[model samples]
Target: MRDRLRATLALVVVGLLAAACSTGGGDKGFTGTRLETPYQAADIALTDTSGLPFSLVEDTDKPLTLVFFGYTHCPDFCPLVLNNIAAGINMLDDDESAKVDVVLVTTDPTRDDEKAMRAYLDGYNKSFIGLTGDLDTVIEVGEPLHVYVNDGKKLPSGGYDLGGHSTFTLGLDDSAEAVALWNQETSAKEFAADIRTLLTDD
Candidate 1:
């Protein structure tokens, strides 16, 4: 299965370059995982910070939809990834940057209530959208993307234990399909460049 997926992704990358070149240049590659076969957006929906229904489909108009799954209480990677995204957005031209949507979904939904989630993401960028709801919904939304979310154990203190989750960011194309992925090690500049390519590419 893994090998097949990789092979499919190789084809996806080639198609993207060929398709993108017709629109413009310098969009032939990216610093992230460019799949040969695009990932179809799943049918999962969750509650946004504003208590409204939220899904990647809602941001399909945007050239790119970046999704990350982690808990608000996460000690390191979560905040770092969000910060990288914010920095990446800053690297884009105003109009191109505006066309990107960053969505962070809570793996620990039980503890990451709307208020907490909003506050946490707001610290990174006011434009960031935070989503939280039942754990099952979160899992369903992340499953297709290979984002695992484990509800953490309880601790002696009122706080919960650290949770385990995938740390890669899934990048969705204009039609709301995931076509690329970037890990925590990816820099803001790299992400911004890839996003710009997606926007300008046909």
Candidate 2:
């Protein structure tokens, strides 16, 4: 079992390397960059804050699905990314807002309980969905998305420390195909514009 797990993790690392070097980001006016090879959305199972079984394919209800991976305890990037997303979503009219769904998957499942996840997300947008599960399960879902998650540091106290993660948000079209990616610098208005293009472009 240990060998298998290590092998799987090795493959994930290789995939991340390849993805990082690929020449994607080709769009003209997108706030988020475009990937030359838009990854096919991976359908992994996890539990939502509401205790319901969730999978990417089943949970994505709109034409555009935005997926982010990070922990609630993250003192910087995570909240900033979500806040940007919420702002982007708010920029849309009712019709446009209804066309998108934003999801956050926790990297620090050890400390991020349902209550914490719910409260953190509610501060940004009530409609945003938060997902958490066992460590292995979260890694399985995150790996294909090129989200690197660490178990975190150990504190002098009994509690575990917060970990780090890749701070990019992925955008997927209705076909469940990855279409765009946004880095920490992306603005809400730019994100909204890219989303609109993704929903309409061929």
Instruction: Name the runs in model 1 displaced over 4 angstroms.
Output: 1-29, 150-165
lDDT of 2 by residue, 63-110 (tens): 898998877777777778788899989998899888899998887777
Query: Which segments of model 2 are wrong by more than 4 Å?
Result: 1-26, 151-165
lDDT of 2: 0.74
Backbone clashes for every candidate come to: 5, 2
TM-scores, in order shown?
0.78, 0.80
Candidate 1 TM-score versus the reference: 0.78
On the 0 to 100 scale, the lDDT of residue 128 in model 2 is: 91
